[model samples]
Every structure is written in structure tokens, then in C-alpha cells.
Target: MTRTSRRWAIAAAAFLAAPVLAGCAAGFDATTVKHYSPTEARATTVRGIQISQGFVLGPEPGGKLPKGGSAPVYLSLTNIEQQDDQLVGVAVNNAGTVKLAAPIVLPRDKRVSTSGAAAPGATPTAGTAGPPLVIEGLTKELAGGEYIAMSLQFANAGAVDLTLPVVARSREFATWAPAPAPTTQQTPTTGPTPAATATPVPTATATLTATEDASTGGH
Candidate 1:
């Protein structure tokens, strides 16, 4: 009822609400946002090598990566070992060949990524600084949102198998570049053709008879 009592009640209410507002702010912190978190890309660790954001770039929206065709691969690798390593090979089931543009050299404690700028805040490295991964001659058709069996080999780290997901070229993946189409090589022709030979003409011979003229003179 008094003026001082009313003021004291208002101050107490403000003090109590501050803590609740602070708790709510922490609940919605930007760092906790889903976009800032790791994506749905598959990840695994093998022999101290960390592979993340590993996926196959599937066909365009409403399309499928045709059988006997090709698709691009995107991933990031971090070598946690002291010595360097190299990605020597890659294989996919129902796929003919998984081609790496160059030897992916994983420097010690460095990160290499094939997805080119997909990994946020990833630094450049000998392996990640170059071209993309391409899987050619797919034996089976692939639509988006599917997983395929795959294996990766390292010179020193040995081989690691994975079930990599095939994602459509939409949303966050839309900005990521796709692997270039496989080049078609023509078969070379055989040696030049042989030439035809010509036949020789027989020589004409003419014999003159002088004996008839001599007989006429004698007569």
C-alpha cells in the first residue's frame, strides 16, 4: 500500500527475472544451432586417420546417377599420426573405379579435403588442396539419399571400409562442385592400307623380210 513497499516489490521481481532470461539465452546460443554443427555426412576413424564429411555427390534433383556412369566423391581427412600418409586407392561396390585426381598426401597433423571448402575453417594441405574424387563406371544406378559400400586404402595406414551415403545436389550440397564428366577415349586405328600393284605390258616385236626383195632382184 505504501510507495516504498511498492518500489521494493518491483525491484525484487526484476532481480528474479534476470536469471531466467540468462538461462533462456544460453539455451538458444548460436553455437548450439544445427547449421553450425557437423552435418549428416558420415565419418569414421582408422589407424589414427580421421575421415569426415564423406559422401558421394549423387545425381541432380529428380534424377539418378545412371548405371555405367560416374559420380563425384567429397570428404575430409585428418592425419593424427606423427608421420605423413598417402591415400593410395579407393573402391566402391557396384562401381567400376574410384579415381583420385592426384596422390592425396596427408601431412602429419594436417587436414586434407576433397569436398573443397565444404569443411568449415579447414586449412589447406597437400591432399585437400587439389581435385575431387570421382567414381566411374557405376554398375548400378544411384538415386539420392542412399548408402553404398566403399573402401579406402592408404600406403601406410592400410585399408578402411565404409558405407558412404549418396546425397542429392540440393541444400548445402548445392554449392559444392561436382566431379567433371569422364572423358571418352576413342580407339586408335590400325596401320595404313596396302597399295595395289600394276601388271607389265608385253613388248611388241616387228621382223622385216629382206629375202623376198633379194629374190626379186635375182629374177
Candidate 2:
């Protein structure tokens, strides 16, 4: 074969292989590439109510409560509608009975916090007063790194199920610990009953004196 013909033949072969190599590279890139985006760690929206940042404040060090004790849950509820709603009930599985101190009024276009600062007229002494929700009679001990399944029932928004994270009582959440159990004061017992006052009796001599005075008048 002529040398010029041989060079042209080799060039043609290289061009054909180049397209195949490019196709292989494109296929590999499509499968290997990964995309990532930022998202909320814990949040959920149901109906018009938005529930987010839900967490259960853990017990203090060495202060864990036994089964049948109570704990507190904190979360943010945002009402995105123009009308009002109420957080009337809560339920927890394997955690015991859940009770709301009061039904939380979810005003339209507002966010209510279960923790944080006390609302106006809210008693600061009862730590859970501001939150309105308290979980009493815990069936098991919950600590950091644990989670519980909770269901929140709203008057208008319906019910939302949440897997709430248990955060340790530390740093900013230190103050979010459950309030101490209320103590009942006992009344002092009286030592003994006082003796009843004795009724005064008229002396026999006074009665006789009166009788003699009456006889003298008659005489």
C-alpha cells in the first residue's frame, strides 16, 4: 500500500474510536454525579398549620424519672391561615399519658413556642405553663439520643404524627427541662380539743335567801 494511503487509513480509525470513547465518558458521568441541597432537620406541615423544630427536653443528669413520671415537649406551631386554631390534645406511644395544661390558641399568622420566654400573664414558676403541653406519666425513661412517636391533635388543623427527637438538657436547652413536681403542704394538726366551758349553777344559799325575802314581804 502507498505511505499516504496508510496514514489516511490510520486517521480514519482514530476518529471512529474518539466518538465511542466520548459516549462511554458521558454515561459514566451521568451515574457518578450527586446533587445535594439544604433542608430543615425536623419540620412538618399539615393542613394550614406548620409544626417545626419539635424536640423533647431530656432529664437532668442523674435525675431521670421512672415509669409513670412526666416530661415536657417543646415545639413551634405556626398558623398560616387567616382563621384561628387550637392545639387541644397530644398523644405519645410508650411514653405514658399526655396532657395539655391548657389548649394552645394558634392565632392566625403567628407562631407559638412551647419553650422560650413566658407569654403575657403566664406563670413563670410553672415551667410548662408557657408551652401549654405537658407529658405526664412517662412509661419509660427517655434520654438523649432517643426518640418518641407523638401525635398532636388540633381543633381545626386535624392531627399530625411526629417522631420527636430527645435532646439533652444542655447549653440553650438547659432551661427547657421539665418543671419540678408540685409539692403539697400539710396543715398542722391540733394537739388536743379544748375542754367545753362549764355552765354556772345557782348556789343553794342564794335560792334560800330569795325564798326568805318573799316570806318576809308576805308577813
- Candidate 1, residue 18: the lDDT equals 94
lDDT of each: 0.73, 0.68
Q: Which candidate number maximizes lDDT?
A: 1
lDDT string, candidate 1, 73-107, tens digits? 77788889889998888988776788787767888
Q: Please report, as a residue range, the 10-residue window in candidate 2 with the lowest summed lDDT.
A: 30-39
Highest TM-score: give the candidate number. Answer: 1
Q: Indicate the TM-score of model 2.
A: 0.61
Model 1: residues with Cα > 4 Å off, grouped in runs:
1-38, 123-131, 184-219
TM-score, predicted candidate 1 vs. hidden true structure: 0.62
lDDT of 2 by residue, 69-95 (tens): 667777777889779998899999878
* Candidate 1 positional error at 133, Å: 1.4
